[model samples]
Target: MRIASLRQGAAVISEAGAHLLPMPVGDLVTLGLDRALEVGATALASEPVPYAEEDLLLPYRPASVRDFVTFESHVEGVRRSVDNASGVPAAWYDAPTFYFTNPHALYGPGAPIPRPASSRALDFELEVGVVLGAGGTSLTEREAGAAIFGYTIVNDWSARDLQSREMQVGLGPAKGKDFATSLGPWIVTADELPSLDLDCRVSVNGSLVGQDRLSHMNWTFAQMIAYASRDSVVVAGDLLASGTTGGGGCLAELWGRSGQQTPPPLEPGDVVTMEVEGIGSLTASVAVG
Candidate 1:
């Protein structure tokens, strides 16, 4: 079942429409996946209301956010552009790599994303995100996979110019990325998504610019979770993102391919729409901060 956090409250979405839940969506996460599914099924008996996209909110305020770079093509593309490297580093192939991002910077569907004041090159990353329904430390892949509660579209909005400068210091994509990130429409529970292979696409101002399949990832969400949980505690409501896809996931890849900024960076008022099959679309408008 699809669960959404609406302005009114938590909701269970069905083919007919959205049904209000007696509790907030965050409460459902605390209940764990099995119990949450049970509660969601019961909530579906309530009167259905139109699923107004604008009424949505972040499915829940994440306890923390970890974004993993699992797409080799994306890594290769950006590395060539930024470092002029021949290919991915050997260490990258050994394990899933990620960075902790600001959990407080989240926005929901239809929200306006502010372009960082210091940034001149703002870009959108098309990705798939999962919410954990159970907590564990040093989890195995199987255990980690079972911890997944649901999936959603993620836009890891980037200030490319600022990111480049910060990475030169040997740490951080901090201020470069901490400004904004988008998640929502809603979350489709793990049971509903038995397969991870899905088509992912992004469009800007109504023009289709990039597309990739979720199957292209070099690492699975399970691996990402396991890697993240190693000697660390990961709890319910934590957000994990499968980083930018290849085959045009972001403009940096485009620049890498062409060796110049072909399409200019995002400008105020530019609308970005990212969609992942089975989950849904998440669109955000760029605004001057």
Candidate 2:
């Protein structure tokens, strides 16, 4: 089942339309994935509301956000953009690495993303994210896989100039990325997604910019989750993102490919739309912060 958060409340989307849930999505998720699915199913009996895209909100506020770089091609492309002879770091192949991001900075479908005032080189990363329904510490891959509740599209916005400088000091991507992150359209339950091999695409101001497949990731979501849970806890509502896809998932990767910025960086009034095959499209307009 597909669940969406609206100004009214949580909703279950069906062919007929969207049905409102009795409680908010964040609360439903706390009931655990199975019980949440049950609640969603029960909500289907309520009168349906027209599926108005503009009325949607972040599917649910994330408990915490952890983004991982699991795409080898993306890593290689980005590295080459920085240093001609560079390739994926040898350490990168040893484990699934991720960074924590601000969960409060999230925006939903149709929201306007604020470009940080300090950035002139803004970019977007197209990715797929999974929301967890169960929590655990030192989880096994199979256990982590079972904890997944559903999936959604994630637009991990970036400030290239800032990210570059901070990472050089060996510590960040912090201020560069803390400004904004767009998520939603809605979340499709794990059972609803039979395969991870889905097409992913992104566009800027109605012009196609990048395209790739979810299957391109070298490491699976389960592996990323298990790695994250190593002696630490990941709880319900936590979000984990599959880093940018290769084949032009982000402007940085594009610049890396061409050895220079081709299309200019995002400016005010730009519209970005990111889509994943089974989930849906997530669009956000760019605005000066």
lDDT for model 2 comes to 0.88
Q: Taking the tens digit of each residue's C-alpha lDDT, what string does model 2 give over 77-117?
A: 77765344367789999998999999989998999888888
Q: Write the per-residue lDDT of candidate 1 for residues 194-265, one digit (tens) a residue.
A: 988899999999999899999998888888999899999999999999999998899888888888876778
Each model's lDDT comes to 0.88, 0.88
Model 2 vs. true fold: TM: 0.97
Could you tell me every candidate's TM-score relative to the true structure? 0.97, 0.97
